[model samples]
Target chain A: MEPLLKVENIEKTYDGKKVLNGISFEMEKGNTKVIIGPSGTGKSTLLRCVNRLSEPEMGKVILDGQVVLDKTVEKEPRIDLNAIRSQVGMVFQNFNLFTHLSVLGNVTLGLTQVKGMKRKDAVERAMIEIDRVGLADKKDAYPALLSGGQQQRVSIARALAMDPKVILFDEPTSALDPELIGEVLQVMIKLAKEGMTMLCVTHEIGFARSVADEIIFLDEGKVLAHEPPEQLFSNNSSARIRTFLKKISELYGGE
Target chain B: METSSGLMIIWESWPMFLSGTITAVQLCILFLGVGVVVAVPVSLSQIYGGKSLKFSASVFEQVFRGLPALVLLFLFYFGLAELDVSPLVAATLAMGLRSAAYQSQIFRGAILSIDSGQMVAARSIGMSRIRAIKCVILPQAIRLAIPPWSNEFANMIKDTSYVFVVGIIELMRQGRYVVAGSFGNALLVYSVIALIYLFLTYCGLFLMGRLSKKLAIPGFASAGAAMERI
Candidate 1:
């Protein structure tokens, strides 16, 4: 079967300093891949590049056999960017829920606006996702009324309501409080169990161990190590990956 | 001229003052409503539109905001009278356009205060920039604009009286007429009209205050509006 999403040689530079240099990866359908790295290691940049949010100077990102951003195609042909972005939903570290909208409104906005679904149908669809994330009771509550974890779940519900082919989590739990992290991770674990294709940039070692099919260790814009969770956790992993993992577990362990 | 009778005599102009107050309110509503409709797009241009649009919007802001109300009234009333525009119409257009200038800046600042994160999230969910601004950004920004917006409402209420100079006969012009015909102490009559103006201004502000409080963001203070006075 063909890879569901392929990111090839994605090179991005910031202020003449290379942030993502020759990065490449692929996710087959139902695969969950986690990216782990030190700060400013181009992890977040990779995710943004996937959706063409931060335009990579050089790269090809193809989703579901369609070229999202291809240098060769762009010389004469360009993809419909909004259509591509809709298929690839993204969750942010800050949970970035619309402040003025209620939980139901947040989930339903993209449905009614982007997909052009009728209001009644959109609300029906939004309720399913809202229920998936266990936010049915909070549907009328505004983002300001929610805790960090609750807001993140609503954001996840929002992405799910779009019925995306793949979801990108840009350090999804990074901004979450420690106690709140488990609730979001639980929702994610449930998503993975149900075969949701996901690409997560996070330091949750426990999540990578239990859920990610593979974990790629990136350092300074290069993927230094890519291995299965079993080998990665074992001593067979790269010394760099080992050191980073050991360091994080010692600092914020059992995540 | 007796102190007790002075009160009874000024009451004779009550009908005039009442009509004047109603006209003044109508003028305020006309301009303030127009200010909102025009200012939103103008401010959006300033923030998100291309260079030419931004430049044109700024020029609009400067010309309307820089000119005094009296000059705008003069320019519109005198400028449009040649085409047979009525004084009230001319004055409403001028004040409304002027309020739009002030309001656009208010909205612009409020829009800017929102975290860029709000935008990124909107885009991530497949929303176009315009859709995101409409569905996500502006709603929050508009809420933030409320406190300052109410301040603008109060301003327009008093500014409604400025039309008197152009012969619109709102409160001030009507007050002047009543003062002219009165045999009672002129100072007492003028004072009563001043009090009526104060009453109108006060009542309008009270309603606006209630509105701002009702619609304020659930948790956050109106931080976006707070920085705008400078």
Candidate 2:
């Protein structure tokens, strides 16, 4: 099958400094790809570029089959940004839950506002995702009242409620307390097992070891290593990969 | 003797004082209503609108906020008299426009103070810019704006007396008439008028407090009233 999401030669810059230097990757349907690297390796930028949230200076991002951003086409390419974003959900480092909205409202906002679903129908649809994230009982609670772990789950449910084809997790659990990280990781693990297509930028080595079909190791805006967990973890793997893995494992112990 | 007679005159002029106070209160309400109507777009333009829109809003802020309310009232009432402006319209436009400038700044500050994360989250869910602002940004920004907005309300009340120059017969104008008729009662009438202004300010602040408490989200009470429990 054609890859569900294809990112090719994406070059981005910030303040005259290259952030993403010619990065390329692809993901088949139901594949969970984890990108790991030290801070500022352009992992988060890569995910943001997919949805055109952060415009790239050069690249072609194809989602399912359509081009979302092709900077080379013209001086300025004007794609349907909101439409592309609707199909590719993103969970941020910060939970970024709408402070004013309740959990149910957060989940249903996209449905009712963008998809034009009736209020009653949107509530019905959002409830499924809320239950999936185990926040069904707290649906009426506002984002401000929830704990970091609970808030991240609600954010996940919010993205899932959009019925997106693929979801991007940008350091989803990085902001959670060490003990709270497990709840969010478990949710992601379950999603991976249930065959959800995800591109996650995370530091959790245990999660990458368990569920990542391919771990893409990025550094200085380039993919240094991209392979299955077993191959990447094997002794014959590059010392660079081993060193990085050792460091991450030390910071975040294996599951 | 003068003090006793001053009280007697003030008592007799209750009807005039009441009418004048009512007009002054009405002016403050209209000032806020018009201020918000203009401020919302002006403030949003500076932040989200294009280069030219930002420039235009900036010019408005400079022109209105730079000038004194007294100067604005004079310019509108006397300078624009050929355009057929009434005293009430003059005062409303003068103070309302000025109030808009200040309120816009308050709103912009509140909107900016809200982490940009809010906008990112809204857009990630596929909400258009306007929808995101309406549903996400403004809800929190408006709550944050309340504390500073109360300041604007209090300021506008005292400035309503500036309309007395154009002869609107509001609180200050009524006080002037009482002093002219009673002679030597200026101190008594003006003192009572000050007390009345203080009462109006108190009421306005109380209302703002209630509004802030009602709108505050559970964990993020950035600029809502301090009297949340009460």
Name the best candidate (by DockQ): 2
For A1-255, candidate 2 gives per-residue lDDT tens digits of 799999999999998889899999999989999999888889999999989889888988889888797876766566788888999888999999888889998999999998899999999999999999998999999887889999999999999999899999999999999989989999999999999999999998889999999999998998899999888888977888789888888888864
Q: What is the C-alpha RMSD of each candidate to the true structure, in Å?
A: 2.3, 2.5
lDDT per residue, candidate 1, A29-142, as tens digits?
999999998999999999999999999988788899998888645483657888889888899999988888889998999999999999999999999999999989999998
Q: Candidate 2, after superposition: displacement of residue A84 in Å?
A: 1.4
The DockQ assigned to candidate 2 is 0.75
Let me know the TM-score candidate 1 reaches against the reference structure.
0.94
lDDT of 1 by residue, B118-147 (tens): 999888878899999988889888888887
lDDT for residue B122 in candidate 1, whole number 0-100: 86
Candidate 2's C-alpha runs over 4 A off are A75-78, B222-230
Which runs of model 1 end up more than 4 angstroms from their true locations? A74-76, B2-9, B79-85, B220-230
Q: Model 2, range B20-92, lDDT digits (tens) per residue?
A: 8999999889988899999999999999999999999999999999998889999999999899999889988
**Proportion of true contacts reproduced by candidate 2:** 0.74
